[model samples]
Target chain A: MKTDQEGAVRSDALLSSWKQTPTRQAIVDYVDRALQEGGAEYVPPSERVAVFDNDGTLWCEKPMPPELGFILQRLAEMAEQDPSLRTRQPWQAARDKDYAWLGDVITKHYHGDDSDVRVLMGGILQAFAGMSVDAYAEIADRFLRTTPHPTLGRQLWRCTYLPMVELLRYLEANGFTTYIASGGDRDFMRPVTEELYGIPAERIIGTTAGLRYQDDDTGGSVVYQAEMEVFDDGPTKPVRIWSRVGRRPVVAGGNSNGDIQMLRYAGQPSRPGLRLLVLHDDEEREFNYTAGAETSLEQARAQDWTVVSIKNDWATVFADEV
Target chain B: MKTDQEGAVRSDALLSSWKQTPTRQAIVDYVDRALQEGGAEYVPPSERVAVFDNDGTLWCEKPMPPELGFILQRLAEMAEQDPSLRTRQPWQAARDKDYAWLGDVITKHYHGDDSDVRVLMGGILQAFAGMSVDAYAEIADRFLRTTPHPTLGRQLWRCTYLPMVELLRYLEANGFTTYIASGGDRDFMRPVTEELYGIPAERIIGTTAGLRYQDDDTGGSVVYQAEMEVFDDGPTKPVRIWSRVGRRPVVAGGNSNGDIQMLRYAGQPSRPGLRLLVLHDDEEREFNYTAGAETSLEQARAQDWTVVSIKNDWATVFADEV
Candidate 1:
């Protein structure tokens, strides 16, 4: 329904934060083919699902994922209440500001070592054990808005990648339903996704803690329990994608080993799938490292998946930079 | 904003299946206020969520639920493969044409007696354990379209209440996101909801079987496991509503004891909420019984929830009949 002039204006707005590169052309071409009604690669609007990873692909995850920073405050408080907790890992790492041990948890996870990740998860689970969903949301919302990204110097939300956010807008405007399928807690990202990514709370498909609905004197409330339901990462990402959306995504974006399954699941030789693996190789503007993204990078080369170089594909790193 | 003439036309189109009764007036009043942009009862379109119980509330659930009938065929095959299984309760009940025993399971569940219901659950879980979700959906879609309701003399999809589908269409046209929160399996209802209720697969929140995303040589797929992650009934209805939708519904509809919590969850005292309880009291056109809805009817009276009488409020029962 768009005129050629109108379509060009729309394309310019979508491509504003990206340099003219094969990566942008590939993404736009895949989406355009999917939108071409009655064409070979055309998908129905109902099936035009697009999913993304939150921490690294959407924002900077250098010092730590923003969620770990939010829970680090909780860990510090827990260690204060019980001094014995100071001797344990994650809690000890938080208390002493041992950034290396904290960062190693993620790096170890990608390197097929989840021992430290499990220890960090143990502390994280007990941090918000019996809080109401609404109460936990308030804390997460405040932390996301008020605190700075550990090294980025911007408020946590403002550090989101400008090009990725524009792609979300572009896809949504073209009838693709976007979802955040992160290993981060669902309630943790839900309160701010609407403001940061233009994706609403319900569209968020992330790791979930167990919940219980109890009737109280003042109506009722659904509260979070201590149990972990689905840890949506690695092989589990595709599972959550299908479980939540009920369709295979035509497009998926991610940045590490945890994303390989989802990236592979997105595009097929027969189906119109655009798999974008964001490579954080820009040290000047943002943190640069491939410690956790080694396998993902290798697979991108072998599989011909689009590798979005932060230094090459994107002209602006953070939304605030634009 | 609609002109008065346009509004009148829309109202007439929405109300065609309903009779002019106090129940219709109650529903219309709640919706009109929700659509009133600056009114006290007005809700933002983002928060205008409406949830419904699919079995009895949206369609005829008498002569046992349609899902029970679908699974009975599965039970029959199981019984035939192992003749000893024929002696068991549900298998025996299904094989012997003992509809009373099949119906009593639901009646017993609503009456706070879950003995037979548990027996039925054991059979249902093992029925289609390791099939892919897409394969299960195909079976469900065929069964739903080809099978006739026991007494309704129409395809199972055609037996859905005309008035309820109109309500779903009307709500969607008014910018409300509608969902089906049922005790039925999520996959079973997902294949048919879009065609039957105008609701989508992603919008279905129901009892979930365990699933895994398995990668084969030809990419990967999500397959169903022989486990029920969340049996969405009773108090857990509100739990799934929060887990999937992440927002309290402003409007809800139901017909059984399983739906009581969700109906109560909708429409808080401060926020705008309208709860509708459909009472199946018509015998000549449709089967009538209060065995499963006793507490629901009592609570509807005590809690001041609107009770929609099938005999009085609806001008038509089925779309096929209309």
Candidate 2:
């Protein structure tokens, strides 16, 4: 139960005696009205779907995305194992700790210039395959347990916005189904989501790799491939969502222009939906430079998407339990 | 360990004893020689993928494909629940038990003459969504367990060819990966393959309706939709398998011309691979007239693919253990 303050429930005070932020309250109020009082005008409980971007929105994307860390680890391992990898342009740059060339390599990979995408994906497959599904889950658990934010020095799991986690729980408590519609690798995320977020692998839709299944023939074991699939980024987010999940989400959460189409897709007046864009307005506690940060937050505001100011909306940025 | 009459250890005789078929032995011997003696010059393990068409090639396709049965069950349920569905052309034909017209309606749906494909698939989604993934697996299991052949009066599971099953195991034992690249719906096949044939959901590539993952707030479960997607029939088989699996299968098994493109893609001398076409030469045990069948097998033979005679090569068809 939530304490009613004005026309909306004070989200912060509901579970604890924390102050309720305006933007969080406003979003909560809108959802409550839509689900309860909006009636036939709004989508029914059955159709009430909410999709959320993982990084930057639900969690931090500051120094680097989580996947970049995985990439960095792989690059370091390869450099140590194969001396020739140190001589390779991008690998050499990474070995020298010069990350300026990373963007160029990524661009080349996307444009089909540097190396065969299949071959590159083969590396991922070889690394991940043959390991049990449980082994991967354990790795994710360990990563989340040990890794802390460089700036805040808070555990990465603790770095998840307190209000947003509540929002997901609140939506679930109500008749709203929530999903982490991320741009990360589907396999990478699947291993951790169920434990961290209570979201199952079936519900967590994301970028995937092409996989081949083969029977190990011991008892019932099967081997799977981990080749890179269609990257779910920018405008391709909505397109990939439609292909993989096959329905327009009723509500969507995003942080930057990368999520514009996803928000827009949810914002269509024809479908009863809600879209929220998280704006990084807190600079004291977190690195905040809206419209100018490397992640393209400017174009999102230009589109007139509903922006939630973190400085004003969130009373506590990270979880108190940790 | 298996011993031959000459006191030599036979590589495949372990699986061969369980299978006990002349056709199975022939396939094992051929593939074994190609991999061992032929070396890298002949069959590389990377190119040792074997794809089998599900319906007739692997299981019984007599009355109809299993997916069609599932679809028909869904259609009947929808027609009964929604009276308006009876007024629709295909539904009306289905309600009246006009299977000939139903076939025509299905053809129109696939060939793009009728809008029934979308509506029918929507009906399937509504019918199956919210059903637990476990329950769906049970439905497939029950169908395989209880459903008997129309003419043979034996269970449909018993209709699975012993030789083919052994061949699948033999291929996997040796470095070959097997896949069911079929014209059947992909999700529909997912529930049954692992239990029946040792293939996992990740490896089974087939026709699919577009599935949407929704957090069903009402039921607290993820729901999948069975909406029409790019159907894996005729020429689409090869393209879908490559795109979905991202690997060209080296050895392909298909019983009809619907599988021609897949077989051609696998068997091309342009690449190093083997294609085996299963000829339905057994009229006494199963329907033998492939020329007049829904899938024209004669057209496949014209491609000069190696034809496996079901009647001549096999000492046994189905397992008597059941």
Candidate 3:
């Protein structure tokens, strides 16, 4: 792969060279097999769809999912500027960088107090409204360029898993429309998925805040948040997939327990399908743990799901790992 | 314009010719003038969307909106198959084409005991679901091929008001995405909209039912019904438009009172905008009416919105008429 003046590896060629590796070859083979013999004998062309979890599965999640941090930072900024935000749990936790408290805030925002997620989404959207779709893309690009993972110290976008990217391309080349079923915010992911990955904004399904349209002072339109929407992880992933995409994916993948329901939905017992779980077991190369971890891996084994050891199954993790 | 063997005129050349017309030229000049001296500028592209009521504004709505008839036929079929359907108040009235009962049934459906529009949408979707999106397109194409307005005896697709079609094309050409926000059932219009009007299914917002993803007898993915959703007409038009599209349109058009809210949403007093109402007053060329004995004209007058007389503003009502 060619290196630019900044010594950052080019994704365009790393993505192309993925086919040369046995690990990438395995993913491509499985994807091809799923496409050729996955559906019923007389299945129509439109029914083939494969969904992948973006973070951990497609990219590195060690530093934090880009959107979660971006949002947390924005929350703090908004609180510092508005002062009223500190009164709210989420905004208060965000301002303090209290990650644990932030989780509780998100939980409360979604599940507690008879709250509507739309209202939370409205707040999230209001923070970033009036920004053009192109402006969002530029922000994502700038962040990816300068920001490095806290652990790996590699450019965040380059942390995209090599093998899984191959699998995505293989599935797409075979007529499977790939969608990112991420745990990240839908609005945040939408701005950059098409540029970072091949997935379009329209097809990315994830956790979202409720948004409302607001007229700006300059007479422009913006989608502002009124509240938070459902956090599309765990069991809700499957339900949101059904609600949004209106179809069950033939193949699905995830790196941890957060994706079990999505994987289950993809590998529905009634259908012919393929499901994969990525086991982060590369301590020297990446983070590895079973217990007391952000992504619980031990539970995945109990479900009889095939766990791919990133240390063994992948020839590489991030492009800049060298 | 290319005429198919079945005597149906295509939209391609007709759209091209209409753009060059004096009425379309005037609209272009008006928008250009607005943009140049003190024209409105959209900060975000999403707000540039324009929604039009399809039946009366884009084409003829005579002999009642075609979709109302389509739903009536579907309701009759449902009642015939399940005699229990006849016991349902609205279904019984709809099955017998009881016009008087329609207002009460609809009013009750919206304001009375049964507020779920999903029940109605389920019946509509059930009538058409399992048919591939392709098969539905074919049926819609055939309908547009042979069916003509009762008064005009001209293919309904070709009966579009030339000025309005040109207006739609002009907006689209200027990078504004146009949508059909009709009070008609969303499912009924989707089948033929893309072929006849060039609007995509996702962009069409109308009355709809609740749908669920389920396995068919052969274990294939399918959209099944749970209940009826909102009917996209009257007050619900603006609400559904806001709910679905998430942006207030910069431009809106309609020919009846059902479109009043939609027009108002677009022509909000604070924003620089335009909202045009097409008044069908060409009796010799098209059916002329301001207030019908059983229509919503009084509400239209009360709103004090722009009223475009077809005989004067429109140089031609239909391609053949011109």
Candidate 4:
């Protein structure tokens, strides 16, 4: 019910950080219609749940997801202690800088059988076992602070899309509870999500591992166990959302095939919902290849979901340096 | 930084619904100390996480938890179709109204080994498999609307402690994000948590079951799978809190040994936190037996955690009738 000085509902100011375009205007109109009292599309505040895919939708994922960099750094550190790690599929891929092997692992896990995916996930978990949550978070934080994106030439954390950040705040101003349903590691994302997207740790759902509480000779702490708990991607995304959030989302956004199931789930037949896909076609400002997201773009066009062209919709991709 | 017309911080109005007591005063003082600008105990709003046990801490659990009632009803309905259920351990106990057998099952599972606990939880998950989330919620809602507490003679939902409800709102008013960490079924609690405690489905963390999304001959819907996802109780309480919330709670309240680990976790050595135990000692208003909570009471005294006596701390147990 909040209004700006001009007496317009505050959600109207959404996407002000973006270039004025039909896509931005469409989104603002959709939000306004859903929030207006007595309107046909008006949704109760409690049911106005919005979900966003974190990697490419909110921040840069090209030149690899920042978590992959963190993982590679972790693998290198582990390989130093255990020479056996240098020969493993994921570890060898990281050590030898084998993009083809890494890409194959990721693609196979996404489109392969359940057991193969579990094996890949299990390997990732085993590498992180015995690590305390605080220690793991410190590793991620250090990587964010020191590492610059290979292509963007900026600190990885600073590469978030400014327009998407505005969209998040705008939805919240209209009483929507926004959540991040990413395919990244849940623990790794939690340490920086609040700082980056104004989303709390509890509001972020992603791949998780089993944790064990231990009190031993050293001290009392909870340590991550080497077991995949939830794989939050593709079909699992909708299932995890149903289990964790309970409410079906009214708005969903993503930029890849990994998010197709979640987007479809949010667009329930009985409800009025918004589904958006961000197309990474702006090579000048941001990396512009859709190497793994071709199917997502095709689906967006076929289903009439809004597709935001990064070059056309966003005027700025990052905050100006102070 | 919210204040009343008299310029006093607003959380002072927190437990106004309850009779003023030393315990209430102590709680208010603790919260205020943690919120003061430059106080040693000052905690930022983002880190102000509070957790509450649902059963005895917020509502009546004596004469058995209300969920048991719903479970029994469900068992009876299932028995009508499958008579073999009447011969099973849990189903037979519910069908025959054998409290002793049910009590033994609960106690044994709590004190038993990991495999024993898993078997018990697995049985529970099997009973609820194939049930849609919406359908399950409707069943819980219907039971709540008609069923009455055996001793209080009020609708089951009406048996919630008014004082604790006030406390939950008070914490929220002061920027605390409150969560219900219960041993009850997550799906069962979600149906009524919003109405009973002002907590949404997402904030209620409890024992969960695996879910599968299937597009069958009928239609596409998410169904409960026959698997124990997380048995959130005792040691698992703190573990689940770390996994789900990703922040250690600043305050935790419970009423039984099932909550001991969570209480201890909240009372970390390095942080300023509050741990509260609710003791049922008001026979006239509600049940007054601590049959299973003696260890919790002993720990409360040993650890200097605040203990709330239902007889002394609350002026009213339930809301006034219309």
Candidate 5:
């Protein structure tokens, strides 16, 4: 973190991941004007909210999303206990190590198809049922920090996009409260958000497992019930954001159609809304696929939103590389 | 707000509401130790959470809760349009100005009787359904700011207990983020919390009307649906607290059986927990009835929690009285 003449903190080291392109300049420019005391783009410190999508926007989702990586291991163990579970899918797919079926479930969800997503949620609810929130959070924290990505040969947390990490720090330095609004499980993301992205547990807005509070001779604790209360994708994103933050985000970042509602809700015609749409077009540097991001990509182009080309904008894809 | 010799902030005027009793001393002692750097009770900035119940704890719930006041008015308006609605419960009670029936329903709910609570909820769901969040917030804000208390004759916001208002400011000066956790509707409480108390819209946790987000050529907006997703009371208060803050609160204040689980959830056995149970024993200055608070008073005696006597401890009841 470096300080400018105005004493506003700037992160030259953090910003090094992005190339000096127009896309990078636009991000800096929006934040710069927001900091101007009486400038037209100036937003009060309290109103500066930035929401980022987790799965494919801030981190890698190829081969599989990291949460799926965590969930699959749990599902496989559960299937091993009850072999009859192998007859149904996502349990069967997990037991067989079928990435294609798991990946398809996610893609189908982005395309507004929830049939496979429901099947996957059924396995998810069973995999973690009755586990205390603290216990599950501890296990997830350990998994994210220790377990290697399936194809990336790196720890799950290390797969986070270096450029977006810089943007979070920059926004935070500029007085914006950053939040993770994603389709991933809230508990799954919260345990690792601060370590991976500088966001705290309370700022994570995501789909959640049904929670039941229990009291006994001992103290009270919350447990995961075998129910997916809300999927928190598509239409549910805006509702979660408003309920959690009580303000519309001035900026939104996304890579999939699941974030369409959030991206659309970002800015008014007169207000400053900066949307960054990450395009995974670099096959060599990182996994590249547009299956889940097709509509997001098309809308980004049509609306003249910032289409961030991974191959063109980012000088380094991962912090480890930089 | 004032600063002490050590340059730490304090509020002499706010504290003037409370008499210099041991109960007030205990409140100050807990905050002092929490602010003492490197001391045993010192808490970091982020984890200092204080949850307060709204209706009875923070303000006067007498003559019925303020939200019930707002809902009753709406119910009466709706009944005028459809006379058939007068046949059923809550609407019938509201339409008739039968304060006896309305007050009995609240008291029965505290004794673990939710039958009447359900009827009241049915009225609440229909009263504000199909209204956009912004539209509903505006109406609630106006009602809370303008409506006079039925018996006290004070404006709704000024009905807040003066001593608790001081505690909110004192805690805020010392870096605690206060929240309102109640059985009242989240949207209904949010609009008036900041002006009435020092808390913000995001920090108000309560039962919610189901929310649906709509998008069109203009933009996206969220509307309240008629469904009551979860009645945020009793066992559910802890669930709502955990879901909202992702941490157990250090301090809690309440005045009824509805807040038992929340007060119980305040502090862990090993951690610092300060529970304040307000005893409404002052009929001269305020309403005096222990009907709904029967169990809370019993538990306060058994557990040795701070039993705040409005008649004995308060130097003043309302801020305007000063």
Candidate 6:
């Protein structure tokens, strides 16, 4: 509500929850310039589309993504219910908490044949495919409430980056239609996205499986199928964005090479756009390993994107209560 | 800007552009009751989702869908450039404006193997594959500006229903997030949806083709592919709605059997919902044929849904200027 020297409302106050750093300043300046009524870069409120990558950009993805942890836990529960699942490949690995095997599977997913990844993803999806969406949401909610982060010793949902939460609010206040474009399962993210980041389920675009519609003695419901519909990673990110959002985003934020295509799509030469990369370099507050982020970091430097170093730029990482 | 009897702001003034009829009154009352603070049926702003079927609900689709017309025109243009295309089955049918062949193709699409439909859609998509989204949008805009409705003697874009336009604005003013869920091509609708309706491109969901991302000497762009990713009709409508919108709509409006599943999805037994069917029974203002909509009308009566009679309920169909 504060006004500037020319009696225009200043936007920096909206980001008071964010630390005063070069990275935050750049975002405020860019938003201000883009919102100025008569400025060359001024984009109308309707056209202010901003997309953010979920896992590493908005929340902690250090030891592993929280969804992976949930999937493993769910697999273990299923194994306990059905003893036969304990003998299965992916379920056995998950039940035993075999990080090496899981890591090998993930590596094979990225470098080796896609069938390996498909097997893992397919098994995970098949585990809970027949449940109603409401029931699945309840399971996610229960997991989020009871499970603690491996290293942070807090609830998994509470481990979200405080600065990014404030950034989402700040952009929304400036009339930017924000969306979460993630590689995570769409249903998995929907249960907590609104509560955590003020993003509704519809505003979330993610990897998905096909769904089947049914109306029998149990009444009508849509059931999730084990079939993978859209992978929604790397180049497919931009394609899904185009398919669902139908507009090229004016701003994009990410922290991995999986988001390179989305970032490049947002930062097109024909229009003014902003690309932000969040760097995890604070070992004290968060993890500091960048094993898979080398290409992303190189591209950020080469393209002169706004790089937010957690150690230097964030006054806080997780909320105090969290 | 007007106030009601209790000195509270009333949103009905926003719909003054609409006709004063029982159908309009029903919608206004329903919205007002649902939005009342202490009402039993009160819905939060974030959960106020309203979805509409585009082709027949929002605009005129008499002789055929306007997109079909546009596709035929494009096919004829291609036939001129490539002489060999004149002998191609789908292309030749479109080029010659052979209604019998086109009707057979459409009937086969609905009843025959999916691959038959795929062949037709693939050809239509391939006709414009590799074109940049912006360039394709320009082509849609040019076609919309130049082409007139065969019977109406006005531009196709000008043939939209006025009452429905007011309803879209009214719902939006009441904090409902409006989405157009159509069976039309996704890319074809994006160019004109924003200008025609207040809804933005991101809120529009429809059938889509695959896209490819490439960065060559001419800079970076996403190109359309000759692939049919989703055929959003009938049962597929609800599936796509669940896939993209995530939330089931509280209000749904449509005009044909293709929208039956979507309307049923919206009118779930667990929640308070509205299902509206626009009956094309007006011979003077619009077409009077219900060749394919008999099932929808019967379902509307059986389900006790709101049946909007165009002849009796609408004071105006299209704008006077149009």
In terms of TM-score, which candidate is strongest? Answer: 1
Which residues of candidate 2, in runs, are more than 4 Å off?
A1-22, A37-40, A103-135, A219-226, A291-304, B1-206, B209-322
Q: How far in Å is the alpha carbon of A14 misplaced in model 3?
A: 8.3
Candidate 3 per-residue lDDT, tens place, A34-125, comes to: 44443342122355667888777888766456666676667788899998888785677678877765444444533333253344444566
The order by descending TM-score is 1, 5, 6, 4, 3, 2
| After superposition, candidate 5 runs with Cα above 4 Å error | A1-14, A33-42, B1-14, B33-44
lDDT of 4 by residue, A52-137 (tens): 99899998987678887788777667677788988875677667777676656666654554554464565678789999887888
lDDT of 2: 0.61
For each candidate in turn, give its C-alpha RMSD to the true structure in angstroms: 2.6, 14.3, 8.8, 3.3, 3.6, 3.2
Per-residue CA lDDT of candidate 4, range B1-322, in tens? 4322321256456676666787887788778777775667777888899999998888888787888788877766776678888887566766788888666666665454355345445556767899987788888888877898887878887988999998998888877899999988888889889988999899889988888776542224677888877778888888888777888888999998899888888846556788889999998988787766878888889878899988998888899751
Off by over 4 Å in 4: A1-12, A113-123, A215-220, B1-12, B17-21, B113-123, B215-220
In terms of lDDT, the poorest run of 10 residues in model 3 chain B is: B1-10
Error of 4 at B208 (Å): 1.2
Model 1: CA > 4 A from native? A1-9, A82-84, A268-270, B1-9, B81-92
Q: What is the C-alpha lDDT profile of model 3 across B88-148, one tens digit per residue?
A: 7446766887866554444454333344344554456666655543344455556556666
DockQ values, each candidate: 0.65, 0.03, 0.12, 0.47, 0.62, 0.53
Candidate rank order under lDDT: 1, 5, 4, 6, 2, 3
Of 1 and 5, the candidate ahead on lDDT is 1
What docking tier does model 3 reach?
incorrect
lDDT of 5 by residue, B1-322 (tens): 2223221337454477889899887887777776776666666677789999888789998878899889999898888788998878888888887888888888788887889988888888888788889899999889888899877867876899988888888878778889999988888888778877878887899988899889875457888888888788888998888888887788899988888878887877666678899988899998788887888888788777798899999998897742
lDDT, each prediction: 0.84, 0.61, 0.60, 0.79, 0.84, 0.79
- Candidate 3, residue B311: CA error in Å? 4.3
User: Under CAPRI classification, how is model 6 graded?
Assistant: medium
- C-alpha lDDT (0 to 100) for residue A263 of candidate 4: 81
Model 2 agreement with the true structure over A84-156: per-residue lDDT tens digits = 8787644455567665555444445434364643334455555566554435555656776777766777777
- The alpha-carbon lDDT assigned to residue A243 of candidate 4 equals 75
Q: For model 5, what is the alpha-carbon lDDT of residue B304?
A: 70
| True-structure RMSD for candidate 3 | 8.8
Q: What clash count goes with each model?
A: 1, 1, 26, 0, 0, 0
Give the per-residue lDDT of model 1 (tens digit) for A38-91: 677877888889999998999778778888888888898899889999999888
